[model samples]
Every structure is written in structure tokens, then in C-alpha cells.
Target: MARLRVFLHSRLVLSGLLAVTLLAGYLVFRYFYEVAGDFPFSQEMLLVFIGAIATVLITALLLIQQTDLELRKEGQVLLLDRKAQIYNALIDHIGEIVEKGRLDPAALADLRVLNHKLAMVASAEVIDRFSDVLARLDTAGHDVLVDEAERREIMRAVAVLTYWMRRDLLGRIDTEDEEAVLAAIKANNADLE
Candidate 1:
């Protein structure tokens, strides 16, 4: 049933139908010419046949283009959903560290896994921002004391990373926008401290 539906909806099937219709029309015209002998083919009949064929072919092309666009849109939505999941996981990991006041062994491991996933699914800009956050965390080390300034910097990095991921998920990130987001993160952190 699925195969039948696919075949019916295929562009190749439409092309085949157009070819068959043209062939059948040509055969019918020929048969009438042969049977009627001296009867001439009317220009009106020829025009009607051409017009009908044009209409069918144009309709088929439009349907095919529309189907292609719909499939692309569906695929993009799925991709964005996956990216959102990754972003959420990253945020949760960051939240855990912020709440705990130090990165633990388990959190570091989870961050590593999330970082790898981000590399696989995230945009270059997002990955770069995330990498900076990861670098800061690594420098601080597991169970190490983080000064207030260092903690604030880490928070700022995570905030900037979240902003980049959100922009990417919404398909609105620009080249200069990262700096703006980072600056906003810095300003917000200042207000908090």
C-alpha cells in the first residue's frame, strides 16, 4: 500500500502519465484519420489537445515542487528539534555546576559527552562559544576553588553560549551577533554582582 501511494505521488509517474496521454491522443487521432479517409483534422481539436496536455504537465510540475518544499521543511524542523535538545542538555549541565558551586567528576563527564554531541549537531559559532566555556571549566578543574571573578566569567560564558544556541535554533544568528550577546551577558552579570 505504501509503495502504491509513493508510485502514485511520484514525479516520474506524472511524467509517465503525460507520455501515455500524448501517445493515446496521437493514436486516436491517427485512427480517426485512417477510418474517415478524406475527413481533415480540425485545428480546434489540435489546439484543445495541446492545451489539455500543457495543463496536466504544468499541474504535475507544481505538485512535484510543492512536495519537495514540504519535505525540506519537515526535515529542517526535525533538525532544529534535535539542536534544541542538545542546547537544553548543555544548559542543564551548566545549571548543575552553578548550583553546586564546583564542577564534580560526574558533571565533567556529562559535559564531555554533551560537548561531543554539540560538535556533531551544533553550528560552528555555537561550538566555538561552547568551547570557550569548556576551556574555562577545564582550567578551573574539578573540585577546585573558583574565585568570584572566575565564577562570574564562567557564568557569562555559559550565558553567551545559551544565547548563541538559541539564535542558531531560531535561524537568526549573524556574524556580529555573538559579540553583542557576549556583551549583554557581561552587562547582565555586572548587574547581578
Candidate 2:
């Protein structure tokens, strides 16, 4: 898509330059051919020439506006992509912690980095959801070694955290993208099942 935008912008610029070049060439030809002295200072001819130049300028302006709109849309898509990638990484980390039923300081640090990125880019509701998840993780992480029941308790806590986060985050994505994120989350969760 970026390549397409670059190509389109270049084409418009070339077209505008070609139009201006043609207008200049015609004006030079007029000065030397038939309008050298017969009407070198004719106001009527000058007005017509200026009008033609104005038309070219208006066309160029329109092309630039089109390019600007395309670039803005491209930027929006890039931002969305960044947000999605960060969210996915966070979801993956949470799934790992849930399935393993344990987390070290290093793993917790990595998850925090992921959470920070999402907090910065996601909507307010999504940020709140992540905050809830972080709080739960902090609470469950106090005891690293325990029995099966305790491990299951930790798993339950992690599940609740990620479920709410995914729910809120899905609301912000488009329909098609929401499905993709959900499918990825499901795939990541299958390891636990």
C-alpha cells in the first residue's frame, strides 16, 4: 500500500510538471511565432494566458489534496497495525504464564513491557482492562511454589484477567480484525487445553 501511494504521488507530480512544462512551451512559442510585435502587450492575450496557468495550478492543488488524504489513511492503518501487534504479543505472554502455571521476575518484566505498549495505544476501556489483569497477576504472583489447587487458582486468575482484556480490546478492532485476534488468542490457548 505504501508502494502504491508513492507511485500515485510520483505520477501526480509528474503530470503536474508536464502540464506546466507544456504551458511554458506554448507561451514561448507564442512570443516568437505570431505574437512577437502584433500584440506583444495585448491585455486580452495576457488574461487568457494567466487563466490557463490558473487552471493548471488548480488541477495541481486537487492532485495534492488527493495525495494528502491517501497518506493520512496510510498512517492510520500503520498505527492500527502497531497496536494489534503489541496486543497479540501481550496475549501470547499471558497465555504462556497461564499454561505453565508459573512466572519468574524476567517473564513478569517482559509482560509489563507488553502491557505498557498496549496502555499507550489502546482505548481507555482497554487500558482499564489491562490494569485489572496486571493487578490480578501481581496478586497471584506472590506465591511461586504451591500444590495443584493453588496452581489451578492462579490459572483461573490469569484466565479472568486475559478474558476481560481481550473482550475490551476486541471492541476497539474492526469486525474482520476482531475475528483474527480472537482466532490467534484461541490458538495460543489451545496449548493449555
Candidate 3:
């Protein structure tokens, strides 16, 4: 999958570059052949070339925008999967922490397995999101862990993640199941923290 993604992206970039190079060559030929001997600076050719370049630029921008949107959508899907796995792990951990939790020995083993899966997913998601957030923070020249304002900003980042999870997972869950998960999460306050 990763290789395929890279191949597709490289293909798009190669195509775009090829297109712009062709456009540039066309403009150079049209200018020299049509206007070089006849006129010093033909406004008509200039406008035409400008329009062509603008069109190519707009197309490239739109394609890049679409790629960015698709990537964001994929990231959201990955994050949702991670959150679900994490929530399950939290549930199992809570069961272990609680009295009369109803989970059998085999269930405990399953919970440990869930935690492993959760760790993999969560690590990937965190690495991606953290890279993004840190880039933003760095660009803004904001200290990541210094002032109260920065702390609030970080909290907002966390809230956004939770909101995404709520929309993707909790919203789709049946009412009772949703409530149960919320209850479990609430009971295990340390899980989210």
C-alpha cells in the first residue's frame, strides 16, 4: 500500500512537471516564431502565454488540493481505527482495575492482545499528528510546554482528536453500547489523560 501510494504520487508529480515543461516549450516557440522578427514585445502573445501558464498553475493547484484532501481523509480513518483500539484497551484495563468486572481469564488475555493492537495504532496516529502539530507550533513560534496559552492550545489539539473519535466511533455505536463505552471511559479517567 505504501509503495503504491508513493508510485501514484511520483506519477502525479512527473506528469505535472512534464505538462509544465511542454507548456513552457510551446510558449517559447510561439513567441520566437510568431513575434520575434515582426515585433519586439507583442502584448497579444504575452497575454496568451500568461493565460496558458495561469491555466496550468490553476490545474496543478486543484490537483494538489485534492491530494491533500484525500490524505486528510485517510488520516482521519486511521485515527478512528486507532481510537477504537485504544478505547477497547482502556475498557479491558478498567475491567482489571474494577471489582466484579465480569471479564474471565481468557478475556483478560484478549484484552492484553487488544492493548498490543492499540499500541501499534496509537503510535502511528500520534507520530503523524504530533509531527503536524509540532510543525504548526514551530511555525507559530509558540513554546510547546511553557505558557498557559500554549497549554490551552495543546488541550485544544487533544479535544480535536477526541471530537474526531466521538464523531467516527461513538456516533456510529448503538445508543446503549455508546453509553457503556462512555461509562467505561469515564470510570477510567487515567486512560484519556
lDDT of each: 0.79, 0.67, 0.55
Residue clash pairs of candidate 1: none
Candidate 3 structure quality by residue, lDDT tens digits, 101-172: 233555446645654655565545443443443343443333222343443443345344343345456447
Which scores higher on lDDT, 1 or 2? 1
Ranking by lDDT: 1, 2, 3
For model 3, the superposed segments whose C-alpha errors exceed 4 Å read 1-50, 101-103, 123-193
Residues 1-193 of candidate 2 have per-residue lDDT tens digits of 8867776777677677767766876676566556456655564666577677667767766777787788888988887778778877886887677667777887889987887788778777667666766666666677853345554544455454455566654456577876676566555655564
Question: lDDT by residue for model 1 over 101-170, one digit each (tens)?
Answer: 7877788889989989899889998999998998888776654655566677788888788777877887
Candidate 1 global Cα RMSD: 5.0
TM-score of each candidate? 0.70, 0.56, 0.41
How accurate locally is residue 121 in candidate 3, as Cα lDDT from 0 to 100?
A: 56
Ten-residue region with minimum lDDT total, candidate 1: 38-47
Judging by lDDT, tell me the better candidate of 1 and 3. 1
Evaluated with TM-score, which candidate comes out highest? Answer: 1
Q: In model 2, which regions exceed 4 Å deviation?
A: 1-48, 145-193
30, model 1: CA deviation in Å?
A: 6.7
- Specify the highest-lDDT model's number: 1
How high a TM-score does candidate 1 get? 0.70
Off by over 4 Å in 1: 1-13, 16-20, 23-61, 173-182
